[model samples]
Target: MKTDDAVSALGALANEHRLAVFRLLVQAGPEGRAAGVIAEKLDLPASSLSFHLAHLTRAGLILQRRESRSLIYSADFVAMNDLVGFLTENCCGGASCAPAAQAASKKRRAS
Candidate 1:
């Protein structure tokens, strides 16, 4: 991804509500969730959730679709992967940093 695109994605995720919404959508996978369901699960007002969803959608981090009467939202996994790849492309001087990062992540989870 380009630098500006990465920055935009990061900026979108910088907010608490937006980050929560994005993470929830990621966990929900490609099938996604309805707007009402997301609002209920996140305990957010419909208006507030709509604002965050719009921000994410504008950032190209998430996608929205109409399913009958409900609006469904899902993470854009390609954009997500591209952002991650961009961030980690030169990590630790490009010496296969993932193994160490994964080991540290596992250790932290085990704690």
Candidate 2:
């Protein structure tokens, strides 16, 4: 992913509600969830959910599809993986990052 793309993706996820929506879609897997399901689970109004979904779509972080009359939303896993790869490129200067990941995990539990 280009730097600009990464920036856009990160910007989209910067909001609390957007982050929650994205995570929910990711958890939903490739099958995704309908727009109504998302709004209900997130306790967000339709207008608000539409706005966030549009934002994530523009950022290429999520995908939308029509299933009958329902609009389903799912995470763009390829884009997500690309963003992760871009961020972690040359990570630890080519050294293993497992140690760092482990440390971070431990820190999270300690807090």
lDDT of the candidates, in the order given:
0.96, 0.98
lDDT (Cα, tens digit) per residue for candidate 1, span 1-111: 999999999999999999999999999999999999999999999999999999999999999999898899999999999999999888898578778989999999999
Worst 10 residues of 2 by lDDT: 88-97
Positional deviation of residue 59's Cα in model 2 after best superposition, in angstroms: 0.2
TM-score of each: 0.89, 0.94
The C-alpha stretches of model 1 lying farther than 4 A from their native spots are 98-111
**Once superposed on the true structure, which residue ranges of model 2 sit more than 4 Å away at CA?**
none
Root-mean-square deviation (CA) per prediction? 1.9, 1.2
Per-residue alpha-carbon lDDT of candidate 2 for residues 1-111, written as tens digits (9 for 90 to 100): 899999999999999999999999999999999999999999999999999999999999999999999999999999999999999898999999998899999999999
Best by lDDT: 2
